[model samples]
Target: SADIIWQHCTVVLISPASALCETFNIKMPPNINVLRGSCVTIPCSFDVESRFEKYLDHTCKAYWSDSPSFTSGNAKVKPTKDMTGDLTKKDCTTTFNNTRLLPGKKYYLRLECKNDLKYTFKQASVNISVIGTLTCSAPAPCWSHPPALTWIPNRGQSQETLQENQDKTKVKTSVMNFTASHLHHGNKISCTAVYQKNRGSPDVTAETSLTPDISYSPKNVTVSVSPSGPVPENSNVSLTCSSNANPAVRNYTWYRADGDQEALIGTGQSFIVTVSKVKSTFFCKATNALGCERSRNLQIDFQCNETQEGQRLPQRFKTINEEESSKPKSTTQLLRIS
Candidate 1:
């Protein structure tokens, strides 16, 4: 009679249960990918057998384990603060935090009820794979309509992804990527997140900024001479060299070019040379820790000759590009006397 009663009970249980003796079933994605240092959510739902209906309550808890053999009582990763799945409604959704520590592999879910309803869903497993590194992240709790993310001075190729937080809130992360260049140095890059609420609610926004440090060689090196245009013969003139560079220009050098030969004349931000009867070509070099640059040549010439009436002639100066430096000098007629 006992055998007959046991067989009858088994047959009755099978009618209400989804599978033989095991009526509980869970629905969730098979695989999930997330960025390192970020969080991810495993959306899940489940159905319980008729016999276990009495055990379904708010007191039920969810657990995730790395090993398939994990039970409700012996869970490998039971995040006390992060287990967000509500079992009362049959929602087994769970959010995992800081995926960097979780090894990339298959993980199993275990449910523990306040009473006798406890089961481990081994039929369907979730594989957590850490795909890439996180570049930037911002809170996006409004999952219904996710916030729009943008970068200031938008320079790089960006990709947007959804992640979860410890509090089970979704996060909108923007991975703006670009090759590091010296041009990006000292640039104030900002990440702004705009959340457009429904109805008539005002839009909410958040922003963050950072400046990148980059090393680069000297650039835009230029030389400027004082006492613009013509000057008296045998008078002193000032030449200054400047450049745009990181770490600033540490050294400044002045050079004189005569024909095919070049000679170093002085060392400083400014160089003063006395005008002479012979025409001359001069240039300055600005240097920093990374590299150096040479400015265009400034050609100084005696533009005027003494008149028979004993009037003194004036001197003239002009800068030429490097390409024109090799060309022969041309004489200039006296336009006027100072």
Candidate 2:
């Protein structure tokens, strides 16, 4: 019979006197306060450089002081597009749904990762300040009474700039459209209109937000030929218009170069040009709660399907063998050989 006894510090601690037996690291995003009802990305990452033979396993944990003991049920876990417990690159992030970070309360998050050798690295807990919404307002909205410009001449300028006599731009409409900004980035910027039924009784508000890389103005404009290229006599030519404006399009107008006045082109996504022995030049213009913008002019040409000696054929003449039409021509050519 043999017995074995383990001795403490017997080899004088040959290995490095480090706290952890694993060689890996984990990190979290620096800033945490995020807007409410919006998606927030809690970025995390793992590194396993020392042991090439080992694999990477990543796991994230979140805790709120008011919540129960640290449990997986407290948070949602799902495999991202670039993770299988292998942390090779910096593509680790988690999105929290309906975050309820209390104000001035302590919150903690711990990350755990395992490798082929069972080595684990735990990160130092971080703190977060939950500010519901950080809105920096300038007392009241920069309101204006409307630009005093009498007219907008199309041939005048490629783009017109309007302003009030006080050197301020005053575009006074119920709805306001502004150039997208990061500060107003994905934020619920709203405006309350006090008029009509909404006057004096809790202003009627309209809220909206825009993400980066997205243009909030009129977009997705399309122009196509009706009945293909040219519409024959008494044919229907339809021109459709679309945009990315919110609240849909309140109204639309159709305009042509012949007149400065823009006629209301009904409330629909398309306009039809009825050709009855006559055709003209026209273009489409769209408007919404934001503003109105005109599209480039489109030319419609008529065709004379009659035969004329001076004009050449629109297409190359086919040989007799290829011609399927049995109709006789004004003159036919034939050759006789002896």
Candidate 3:
């Protein structure tokens, strides 16, 4: 039922004179998703009632029907040259070509022998869907050293299978379950297949890739002020807002926080403002088509006349005697301010 291989052949256990047609079944995958242009091989095997065992022969034919009715005359895919499994052995495994045109619908298998063995397995059906998925497959011509598959960036849960094609060739498939997010947008995921040779021959490798399209809101929004250090009161400074986003950020709105309320200052990526308070808090909002995000509060320090650099300069000055010794009788005026 899952992506794993089905080995055992199951029987329908139906009687000729009974109404047990619902018991008709087969062993195969329940669901399969493949690329549009690629082909797929369904591993199938089945068994009939013991009474009809004598009717099974090499002349038996396998037909894949789109409908469950036995008399619908709907033999859309008759695996004549591509039927790999031997009907005499009850293995109905088949391969269909030009799968790009196949409809995305469920399919049933119909078995018809030369004598009297005829039945449509309606209970066991396989649904096929064509789309782009994280399933990668490669041919394994040489089983001695089968190809090894590895995913680039090596993430997500994956399962692997070794299946047989119509020509009796082997194929190795790897299906990975991955979740898409903004963190991985624009990143390329690749699947590489490595094949090694025996007699010192060079190795062969094949690879395929997929890129996911992801859209997200703004992130890591922040506001930075020009002339970052402390500035004198009423000094002019520039504030800029920056953020990361897809489709680019549309606009930026600047906000200044006062005591308990916020005031809208301006718009655009950059804004010029005057520092009128001893300390001020500022932030910005970045918006795009998807959504918007607010930045953290940025505190700007303003230098005051008496408590900052203006008043500390005089107290740190050297005394008149100390300044004279260092200057060595230089003719510099030692004017002292009150």
lDDT of 2 by residue, 183-236 (tens): 222333232222123346643323222222211233333444445554346667
lDDT of all the models against the reference?
0.64, 0.36, 0.62
Indicate the worst ten consecutive residues by lDDT in candidate 2: 7-16
lDDT (10s digit) by residue, model 1, range 1-338: 00000000000000011122246687775455444345667788888888888798877888877566767666767755346666788888877676422332356778887788888887666654222211567666668777788878777678988888688977777776554444555555667778787789998777666555444456567777787667777788898787766667899999999987889999999999988788899988877765566787788887555778888765666766422122121133111100
In candidate 3, position 63 carries an lDDT of: 82
Report how far off residue 206 is in candidate 3 (Å).
1.4
Minimal lDDT window, size 10, model 1 = 6-15
- Name the regions of candidate 1 deviating beyond 4 angstroms: 1-134, 164-169, 178-184, 308-314, 321-338
**Of the candidates numbered 1 and 2, which has the greater lDDT value?**
1
Model 1 clash pairs are none
The lowest-lDDT stretch of 10 consecutive residues in candidate 3 is 9-18
The clash count for each model shown is 0, 1, 0
**Model 2 score (lDDT):** 0.36
Q: State which candidate has the highest TM-score.
A: 1
Off by over 4 Å in 3: 1-133, 143-145, 163-170, 210-213, 258-260, 307-338
Runs off by more than 4 Å, candidate 2 = 1-215, 259-267, 276-279, 309-338
